[model samples]
Target: MIKCIPMIIKGVVQDFDNNACKEINLDSGNKIKLSLLTEDSVLRSLNSKEKVDLNLNQIVNFLYTVGQRWKNEEYNRRRTYIRELKKYLGYSDEMARLEANWIAMLLCSKSALYDIVNYDLGSIHVLDEWLPRGDCYVKAQAKGVSIHLLAGNVPLSGVTSILRAILTKNECIIKTSSSDPFTATALASSFIDVNAEHPITKSMSVMYWPHNEDMTLPQRIMNHADIVIAWGGEEAIKWAAKHSPPHADVLKFGPKKSLSIIEEPEDMEEAAMGVAHDICFYDQQACFSTQDVYYIGEHLPLFLSELEKQLDRYAKILPKGLKNFDEKAAFSLTEREGIFAGYDVKKGDNQAWLMIISPTNSSGNQPLSRSVYIHQVSDINEVLPFVNKNSTQTVSIYPWEASLKYRDKLAMSGAERIVESGMNNIFRVGGAHDSLSPLQYLVRFTSHERPFHYTTKDVAVEIEQTRYLEEDKFLVFVP
Candidate 1:
């Protein structure tokens, strides 16, 4: 069967044009025809500046309703999306279902959305109205059109990019990743399904062009962006940075590695379970996924045994996704190298998971398909040398309280986020992603200064600047 995905422009689904369509083959022997945008359509979308009159609450409410629909397992669109994920992306049945649940959770958490805005922008009302801050009224204004260059490794990332743009009130133009084009389009279709003419829906455009094939359209779109958000490997991030307008704000969610540190764990089973979840989820594709494990205390042998059991259990629960020939070959090579190096290696049945415990720090390639390298260290500080800001995004520590002791050092060493071993996927409110608040970059903070009649904090009486300067009284009010 063939699935035809149409381009969405300003809330309207475009008619499929054979001349402007790209067909992608799935591993399941099916095909997907994705609609492409032309130069004329791009200009029309750029010129159409329909204001989003809906308030923050209104947008949240609509998204919550859509989320409710997704929560229903029988929802037609939800079912189709999961089916396509299984077919096109080779996601297991359980993983596909989990992805849908995550989307629901993201949209249904209305309070979190409000909290995110308040935490990132100072106040929830900053987007809707100016709030008095210090001596002036301040508000965050959207930075016009936001261009999202999404990575397909994690579908939820694309959802997050689009959601952030909508929450910040910026118009969104998303270029779907070739590896997973269904997610963003499905999300946009849900918006249209809820209310086609809704401003939030109308404010979005989802289309795709190969990253390397067509430079003309991508460059033209990049030129119109007020902000460019790039999510993917180093090359993708560099392309977005190079092509984006010189004045545009470019936010990069580039490649970064994460690791776990287990020190004197009370319950070996519990700690093993948490570490397994971090490694198994997304098959180590996400930046927060754990790739290395550093054990600080004793019982290294016991923990390895527990970890192997947990990995086997998770393999049955969420089975690994399909890997191409190159990926399979790489996985085999890494295992062979570990064996040749005299390291302790434990693998699941049918290559479900691979674990290599090295006596020393190993610098081997991480063939990330539920593969992790473990290093046994005598002290926690020993891991510091390996942690650096330029590449480390997350450092999950077991025995939650251990974070209190090592968080400062980890932050200084370049870890962007610190969390409990199993909770890497749950990014709490008020936390900085990639060491910065992303919403801050999506909008401009504009301040309306208080009038001269308003008394200054230092000067009790209202005074004009000109009078103070002429009378040589400026220094008198300095205190």
Candidate 2:
């Protein structure tokens, strides 16, 4: 008899090669290998399933067990598990540890514990005060739901969606991302170690399958689930949405990009240098990390030149990943065209960085290839339109002063959140998921009771009347 638990838990565990321990190249030169169980593997897992029964009471017990175990094991003590994982995956110990720590934090924040307590206790202190408490469906009476999570690449994203489902008191069916299934599997085991009978455990199911057109598996999962929460590109979101029943609520986190603004120069040199790091960190893989920069001032061109110089200094210190090659190639292509402006773009064929001038034209030309893509703009206003068109998530204002003055305008422009230059990647990333760091997005909520309604004022229409009514009660209209 094949045990479902161990069979379902298999993953890539290879010998650590010294060369493979280097930083991962985002490009992989198209040599990327799928790490998780492919789509076929997923279907096969389901096909062999003799029984797919979940008992909520038992799952909840498991949740408690896992949550407690995670809380007991401090981050430092848990480092070894991820260190082993890095060795297995042939990645540098540093990168693996960082990614693992991030995932752990995402799974159980200090705040997450508070959130779980508040949820089980059935409190509605915060939810009552907020507007659009995030798209609710599935009547209050629904119980024991299944959540199908489609994870994204930027580190620790799975935590947000998984926690939300738990907080909502629904069982989860998490489909791990091909790029990162091991982390999720590790998380599940952590729960079992803490408490084998944690109630929440019985309610959750984590699996990975190739993307399939046939709705058989999804339909089965959906049939049992009262809610479906998915995170991915627009196409993945749409697929999940199409399969979801009207009764099931769908929270889809989709494609988004972010930029930063450099308004004034208390210290132009230092500020520009700091902004450059935001672009380059994590090899520019994060959505919130700076991709484009808007500089405002008379000597803006000089400022961009100064930024290029600073970027060069940092480039040597940071590890060269795969994306560096593509960025270098792109810089060369732009230079040949002669459209690049600012400090001399110096990344050669073998170099690991690309620094280009911000195009003066609004052709959406990005100078940095992988980690950073900076552009200097004459007016700060020009950047707003770009943000609106592409949907920027975070806009880090250089000087602290601009935070107050320009916040409303930035919000009006459609940015979901704002942050200081240094804090871009510190916050969690996903859909509408922002930095302040609440565990609400992670685990299950014990009690979520908030009323919702739209008043006439909420949907008011203002009209400038041409004429006032005289004898009659109604106003007269003029053509």
Candidate 3:
């Protein structure tokens, strides 16, 4: 355990300021001090220089290399880091291992990284141009400087924003969360293991300060950023937005909840198993984790029973995460509500999992820890209004074909994405996120005009000739 958390400034570790540093363990048990670096020095360094300047090819290679270091068994950092997360944050071994696996899956592979590049900035130029332009050409460029206000519910958020910033060749400063502060350093260590002097390593700095109402360091950093990416609940997102000045572009990934819709045709047992997986994974802390399960079927009881069995099995495999007093009390309140409403309630001896089948109404605020709220609906449409288009993110459907049929309706209803059941959390880097090409939004584009390109008459003639030669292939650039 790092007793004194190191403060990173311009790729090197800096000493703790005796007057500024304060040590307090927020009951996480693996105690460490918060490295409260002074505002003046950090701001001076940020404004003084541009540390990153890698071309697209070099950026791709750099990330791929970092991934190899994490995946390679010889490296002690990845394994030790994951174990530390489990110990420090009270995550179950399975959950911790799963988190590690996700990192490897998402970042380690060359294909995934390339997928992101191609999907966002088409062909290193204009992508998916519905119409063609003859004179203009466009290319994506970094936004110069970025600040990421990361969320603590999951450690993955820290690395994800880092990847986007680096891939886009932007110099970035990551404000790490109190809950999972170690990931930023672990990622930097992984990069150092591969190539310490690489532009990405040199350009990135990760540090932390307590979230205070008075808006100090974070607000100043946000105000100066070219791009500010905030990941958190509604309140946190709002706070970040308030600090961000007009010139700074802000992207908010706020509190989102996902749900699954199961039809009667689907196998009840298999459906229950899928729901069990989503609920049990991450101990329900992840945004994509399922809280409300809406079923359109007659075998609700059978599905509920199978779900209980699966939860019982997973309880043994991935034991319940330790909870603080507040969390435990919240769980008790939800359980008592179920009992008071006469909803069928059940629990294993370990109390690692809880099931409230056929709850008449569920609290918008969920007790998200191995707990589930099942709602029986005669028609799937009954669940639509509750989805609350603004807040609801991913909606999983049972039958694969059904998703195809209901996709448009779901989109019209404000659902961001519709996927097959059990796969709401699994997404390709190139795939639409929050119904957007997220990478594209992080970048700015530079437009170029070829010298006196074709005249109006020449352009018309060129279009006709081009149409005759290859009608299907085309390109367009927005001026």
Please give, for residues 112-190, the per-residue lDDT of candidate 2 as tens digits.
4344534533332332222233332212222345465665455466665565455545555676655555555566556
* Cα error of candidate 2 at position 381, Å: 2.0
Per model, how many backbone clashes are there?
Answer: 1, 31, 0
lDDT for residue 422 in candidate 2, whole number 0-100: 58
lDDT for model 1: 0.89
Q: Residue 458 error for model 3, in Å?
A: 9.4
lDDT against true structure, model 2: 0.53
lDDT-based ranking? 1, 3, 2
Task: Tell me how far the alpha carbon of residue 391 in candidate 1 is from the true structure, in angstroms, after superposition.
Answer: 0.6
Alpha-carbon lDDT, every model: 0.89, 0.53, 0.73
lDDT of 3 by residue, 1-479 (tens): 55666667656667777577657565456676767758754675466546466566677777777776677755688788777777777777777777776676656676677667777777543322222344666666678778888887877877788887877778878888877777887887677777777777777777787777445665666666888888988887987888778987888888888888888755766777777877877778777788888888788888888888888877887777778778877888888888887878887665677787764355633688878788899885787776767777888888777778767777888887777767866765556767667677777776666553354543433344456447653442111
Off by over 4 Å in 1: 25-30
Top TM-score model: 1
* Candidate 3 deviant stretches above 4 angstroms: 125-134, 359-365, 451-453, 456-479
Candidates in order, TM-scores: namely: 0.97, 0.66, 0.89
Candidate 1 local lDDT, 378-418, one digit each (tens): 98779998898879999999999999999989989999999
